[model samples]
Target chain A: MNKHPHIRIDRYALVRNTVFVWLTAVVVAGFLVNIPRINILEHTARNLYFHVPMWFTMMAAVGVSGYHSLRLLQTGSLIRDIRAMQAARVGAWFGVLGLLTGIIWSKFTWYVGTDVWWNFDPRQTMASLQLLIYGAYFVLRSALDDPDRRARIAAVYNLFAATTTPFLLYVIPRQLQSLHPGAEGNPAFSDITEPVMRLIFYPAIIGFIGLFWVLYTQRVRTAWIKYRVIRDPEL
Target chain B: MEQEVQSIQDSLRAKESISTPFDSIWTGADVPTVDPSALEQVMLSNDKLYVVLAVVLLIWFGFIFFVYRTDRRLSQVERTLEDRIYERDDEV
Candidate 1:
């Protein structure tokens, strides 16, 4: 049996089980706990536990992807390249989820009377742009025939993409006038947030990030196997 | 010690019994007899808790779908290797 030192299945089972239990508890607590309803927000405030975590998980995934990319630049390890690519792909999914969920939330809350599902909210636009950058990274990879050359070029582009992620998701969105809560005023976690909601909110973020880790690890292991058998790691 | 515990429980009960203005307003409101819109009927019921359920389920199913796709890839690789093994046996 050909064994790769980096790709181990032992840790995944334990971590996957833990993440499953943690997220289940998060869901129960998220629904069962009662939050103080405010005007406009109403019960949609429950979204605080779900919608916000998608961004947090995506940001964490970006950090993981960038770290692996930097390692690839240093060592030129194929494993590092595979890890970087898988992380970015999974992270992009999280960003897509965040955008879609935000649309659904706004449709009910802000666009109640109007039929506008895709208002050009600053955060929404910036996030979509960020996903596009990652999309270009994948396109750039596919355009290259040589694996070594592709990994090097994609790593450089991924580093640039990672650097822009924070600016696009947080900084630029805040500078512009927007309906997202934190943009115009104090950050979302201010005096108004209830202590009870925080109980589930923080766990939800951790659980979703944990979920990201599991998915990224799974893809990396599969890519490693394909790399060994078929000599192609692109997945 | 038993008496002390009983007293603490009694105080908690007393706290629950004390009604505030918030409780009064919530209790005094009439249940709506008018028909709710379809969206409201599905999403806004039970304090709009179903919305949270919807979001959670979407994420849950999304992750499940990813796992299934990855499993399929693994199965494909396994089949390819198995085919190669059969070809080697036939040659022998």
Candidate 2:
């Protein structure tokens, strides 16, 4: 019963409720707020609130996972291992949603009349590759049977995966030609994004990241319970 | 077919007039154009707002799927606990 000493249930509940309300507001504002429509983007510009936040949330999740993995390496705490794995698991889900949403958004806007759903846009390609790297981290975990060995090995692999995330998601994509904004010689988001969109966009990012935290924490709590009862911390 | 091509060309011409660096790459003559399939037609309507709807729906479904996964884990834990309790009772 006393296994989850780290989790402050009351604090978690407060943040969870706040996020629930905050994201509701963000979604409402996202749709209701008006922006001057550009040619192809038109109303899909509203995706700025939804699709873009997913990547930001995934990045935040990666940061959390990486930090915990580092701590696990330093202190050899199974709790840190649990946190890292759950953060990665939740983060990868966000990445999946981000990629799928990007596909749908691009299909209509960029592909338009063409049947090309995937044209290997540099950012999209890099993003998928980044997800695969994280996928390997999970696969690597399942391969190892011993908990201590798995945690240490997975932590090392997680660190490597974390290192690749930024380059694949932001740096390499920017270096290449892509339809995504902030790509080589194209308008960066600051130049193209309207001030009105920023009102909702920034908050949406915060809300989605908060949502990630809640989900990640819930998983960690469950893992801790499992660890106490079954003496197996891997979840 | 000719009219569709004409309209696409006209739109390209219009885009060329105000093309940004990103726009020029996608709108270039090298890029092929096609008639919208019935599916594309449905998705591309209303300024492609349906794309936003679709993206939102995808995220919603993703969250639902995650919840189910967590639930499955919880169920496994519950089953294990029940089995352990029965084992202890049998020992008594």
Candidate 3:
């Protein structure tokens, strides 16, 4: 246990508790803080604080996962493999949440009259595609029976998946026409979006990313314990 | 019908005062743009408060799922420890 510092339960409890309090404050501030209403956006404009943070969190998660995957390839440390997998898993969940939130936001604000839930918007489509790439990374892991081989192969695939995430979520989506802000000459957060909104929005991103860290750390700790017991760290 | 007439008059006045094409086109259309179902009507009202409810509920369910998964993993870890303890007792 002393040799494996990653598995040791150190100040994780303190950080986890702090994250819980921080996110609670963010949610409260998110709803209570007044935002200048746009005609179509109305109250749904508030979603910018929540929905946008999810992608930021996902990107942060991807960074963590990819970093660990890189370390795993370099050192072949089992803990690095576990960290990579858990981060990707948690990141994918955040992506799902982001996609669902986006659908609900767009349905009312953009598709109010059409009764459409999914309109194949560029950003939405690319986000789904990005998730699929990560999905393949998971499937690739399950296919391998040997732990060492699985880690090596999955790490490579995870790196690939992470590389493509930014393009799929940000670059390509921006290249095409999208209802999402900052798409096709539409400024992302121009003066049109009130500056006051940033008070809640910036912290919301940090809070959600903090939330991601807490969840990812929990899963990594569990996986590390399981690895010690079973000597196979595939999960 | 009155609301529709009022919408038309509002759009006409709005068009004269402001030429925001999107708003005017939506309001100026001869046919009503939407026939929301009862569920949609309920959800769409009050500035779509129910949409917020739905988003919060979705997040709630997602957290619930994470809780369940964590609980299951804890049980598995507990079972492993229990098995090891039983084996130690037998050895003694």
- Highest TM-score, which number? 1
Worst 10 residues of 2 chain B by lDDT: B24-33
Whichever of 1 and 2 has more lDDT, that candidate is: 2
Give the alpha carbon lDDT tens digit for every residue of A76-186 in model 1.
998999999999999999999999999999998888889799889898999999999999999999999887899999999999999999999999988888888778664
DockQ of 3: 0.06
What C-alpha lDDT, on a 0 to 100 scale, does residue A94 get in candidate 1?
95
Residues A193-227, model 3: lDDT tens digits: 78778888899899889889878887886786667
Which candidate achieves the best DockQ against the true structure?
1
Model 1 steric clash pairs = none
- Residue A2 of candidate 2: its Cα lDDT? 33
* Per-residue error (Å), model 2, residue A138: 0.7
lDDT of 2 by residue, A1-235 (tens): 4323778766877887788778877876786677898999988898999999999999999999999999999999999999999999999999999999999999999999999999999999999999999999989999998889999999999999999999999989999989888999889889999998999999999999999988998888788776766673321
Query: Worst 10-residue stretch by lDDT in candidate 1 chain A?
Result: A226-235
For every prediction, compared with the true complex, DockQ reads: 0.15, 0.08, 0.06
Instruction: Please give the RMSD of candidate 1 to the true structure.
Output: 9.3
DockQ of 1: 0.15
